[model samples]
Every structure is written in structure tokens, then in C-alpha cells.
Target: MEMQGEERIAARRDIVWAALNDPEILRQCIPGCQSLELKSPTELSASVKIKIGPVSASFSGDVVLSNINAPESYTISGEGKGGIAGFAKGGADVILTEDGDDTILAYEAKAEIGGKLAQLGSRLVGSSAKKLAQQFFADFNAAVSAQAAANS
Candidate 1:
């Protein structure tokens, strides 16, 4: 499925980018995120718990950031295993645009699933994926906004 959204964060692009790259901040912002570890400047490992339809699973995987453009845009890709639930692989292009007094954080992502997850049908998987993405963005925006407020 494809997912996209934009969030207005009350912070400079540099500040926002720093937060985005910070694993600790991401762990807190990611919904159902059990853990997030940065292995390199542009690579990370994570585990997240998710409930899709009637199936509940925990997925762990490695994510790599590529095609970097400083304080602007990048492509992120990852492949994760969900035990009997299935496997998932996806990539997203994140773009940051300058907005008055804030930054417009936009992303478009494509995700693919296999194994039991693929057996669950597209509609159910798609809806759940969309919800998860939205939740992550919402949490991220709130966290960043709060951090900015506190720092100001």
C-alpha cells in the first residue's frame, strides 16, 4: 500500500532533522515501538508491535537511510520479519520544506508484505498500514512541537 502525509512542525528544518535522526526521539514517537537502535549514522534496527485485523505480531528489522540531501530529503528502506504473521519491506521518500515559522514534513511510502500477512487480503492490510503511519506522524509532530516549546 501507499501512504502519505504532511505535518507542520514548529521548528527549524535543521532542528527537525536532528530530531528525526535521533533514535531516542523516534523510539518515543513510533507507535508500538518496542525498541530502536542506531547502528550507524544512516542505519538502524527496530522492533514494533502491531495488530492487523485479528492478528497481533511483533516485527523487527533494519532500516537504512539513503539518497541523502542535507536538511531536505532522503529515502528510507527496511525489511522486517513478523514471525508467523509475515514479512514486510518498504521504502519512503521524506521531504522537508520550509514553512513560515515551521517546517512542512512530507513523505510518500510504498510497502509490500508476504507470508501470512499477504494471506490476510489487501484491504485489511492497507487500512491498518495507513493507521499505523498516521499514528507515527501524529506522535512525531507532538513530540517535536513539545520539544520546541520547551527549548524556546
Candidate 2:
């Protein structure tokens, strides 16, 4: 499946960039993220629990950030294993553009699943993925906005 969208954050591009790289911020924003640990400057190990249709599983994954351009853009890729449920892998290209004191964050992402997850039908999986993506961004925006306000 493929997903893409844009959001305007009430914070500077630099701040938004920092938040993107922050493990704590990401853990808080990710829909089902239980933990996000920075393994390296551009690598993270994460655990997340999610439910899709009738499957609920806890997945452990590694995320790597590459093709980075500071305060501008980067490519994030990750894959996870969910035991009997299935496995999933995806990548996203994120771009951040400055809009006055705010930042415009855009992303294009592609994901694939196999095993039992693939058996759930595309409609169910796609809708679930979209909802999770929306929830992540909504939470992320709120967290960033709250932090920006606190800092000012």
C-alpha cells in the first residue's frame, strides 16, 4: 500500500526537524509505539503493538534514516515482524519546507505486508494503515505544537 500527505506545523523547520529525529517525540507520536530507542544517529529500534481487523500483535522493528538534508528532508525505512500475524516493511520520503515561522511537512510512503496480514484483504489493511497514519500525524502535530508553545 501507498500513503502520502502534508501537514503544517506551528513551529520552525529546524524545530520540526529536531523533533523528527528525537526518539522520545517519535515514541509519543507513533500510534502504537511502545518504545523507540536510538541505536545510532540514523538508526532506531522500536516496539509497537497494533491491531488490524482480527489480528493484534506486537512488532519489533528497526528504522533507519538516510538521504538526510538537515532541516529539510530525509528518507525513513523500516521493517517489522509480528509472529503469526505477519511481517511488514515500508519506506517514506519526508520533506520539510519552511513557511514563515511554521513548517510544512510532506511525506510519501509505501508499505507491504505478507503472511496472515496479506490475507486480511487490501481494503481492510489499507484503511487500517491510513487511519494509523492519520493518528500518528495528529498526535505528532499536537506534541510539536505544545512543545513550541512551551518553549516560547
Top TM-score prediction, candidate number: 2
- Using lDDT, give the best candidate's number: 2
Query: Can you write out model 1's per-residue Cα lDDT over 41-136, one digit (the tens) per residue?
Result: 999999999888888889999999999998899998999999999999998899999887699999999999998989889999999999988888
**Model 2: ten consecutive residues of lowest lDDT:** 133-142
- Misplaced by over 4 Å in model 2 are none
Model 2 C-alpha lDDT per residue in residues 5-82, reported as the tens digit of each score:
999999998899999999999999998899999999999999999999999989998999999999899999999999
lDDT of each: 0.91, 0.94
Model 1: how far is 117 from its true place, Å? 1.3
Clashes of 1: 0
Q: How accurate is candidate 1 locally (lDDT)?
A: 0.91
